[model samples]
Target chain A: MEEVERLQHYFQVLSDVNRLRIIKFIDKEKRSVSEIVKNSSMSQPLVSHHLKVLKNSHLVETQREGPFVFYQLTNPKILDILGLFEEMLPKENLVSDFSPMFCCPSWWGNSN
Target chain B: MEEVERLQHYFQVLSDVNRLRIIKFIDKEKRSVSEIVKNSSMSQPLVSHHLKVLKNSHLVETQREGPFVFYQLTNPKILDILGLFEEMLPKENLVSDFSPMFCCPSWWGNSN
Candidate 1:
């Protein structure tokens, strides 16, 4: 693929709130699907779907250990990018509303 | 807007290839709309549209001097994020295709 198309794909992969949540949740340590499901409101299947997208984009990678598989960011620089965004975040967003907008769509049966 | 929503919008703003091209084109120095049009294959209206989106996202800002409006990145850190993406770009993408991808989808009447 061309570089621009690849970048368009990369940014598109990151365009979702849930995907960003998943990326942040697994940023520090690798997490199994069950662990992610247990800690977050996302269902097991939803977590699996986002994980697949992340993997395909080469943003996240998986490791197998026995029967469980753990997922982690492919590069630590991903966090640096996120950190830059955080730094660039306007003060209005930080203070205007502390509550979350929403979790997964109602159809997904998200627990939160 | 919520932080995640704001970020989602920001990423969406960056997801398009033309927007990315425009961002890169204006990265080093601020440029007037006509200058951008003259330098890129994109037309004047399309350049204006992308600049509006970029400005709304706070990724780019504009200045007016007499008859010209100059657009430039709001923060240099935006380039840092792009640099990170470049670093993370796979070797396959860099080496696989040397030809230009279709510019402006052929419908935009791009000169190139």
Candidate 2:
């Protein structure tokens, strides 16, 4: 897919918190749909719908184990997506300064 | 903004190709709304609407140069967002193989 299309798809999948949590969980380890429901505190059908969206975007993939289906982050490129946000957005860090580097030209110059 | 919120807003702005083109142009250098309209093959009102969306998302900012409003990429972090998609997405490169590195475990290990 084109970069814009992929970006749109990534953002569309991320528009929902439920879907974001699903990807985060899957990133930790592959899990079945029911497990996602337990962790996300959302309905099974809702989880299934969100998974379908993720799958369609190619952000995730599924594997069937007997009667259960397991979902995993098939695309490692999502790390770049998450890392992009991590690098751009501000975060709260207890032990250190959590300010974003992009705010300063010096940081940008050094990093680049 | 929070990463999820930022992601949603970025995606929402990017969902329209008109807005995407606006950002891409601004990324190259600051340009007036009229210049954007000329380059993008879009109408003035349409470009205005799209610029409003981009401004709201904090992806692009504007400066009033006399009678003209010049837009520029204020947030360098958008580079990370764009980089995320570029890394994840498939691109065509005529000179060499443009295959994504994410497809292989070795690439991930090496890059990470």
**What TM-score would each prediction reach against the true structure?**
0.71, 0.71
| Model 2: per-residue Cα lDDT over A1-112, one tens digit each | 4566655545555666567667777875789999998998889998887887676556677888898998888776676666667567433321111122334565566421
Q: Judged by DockQ, which candidate is best? A: 1
Interface RMSD of every candidate?
6.5, 9.5
TM-score of chain A of each: 0.75, 0.70
Q: Model 2 segments beyond 4 Å from truth?
A: A1-3, A90-112, B1-3, B90-112
Which ranges of candidate 1 are over 4 A from the true structure? A65-67, A89-112, B89-112
Residue B87, candidate 1: alpha-carbon lDDT: 68
Cα-based lDDT at residue B109, candidate 2 = 68
Every model's Cα RMSD, please?
12.6, 12.2
lDDT of 1 by residue, A1-112 (tens): 5676777777777888888888888887989989888878888998888887777666777888888989998876787777677667443432222233556786898431
Clashing pairs in 1: none
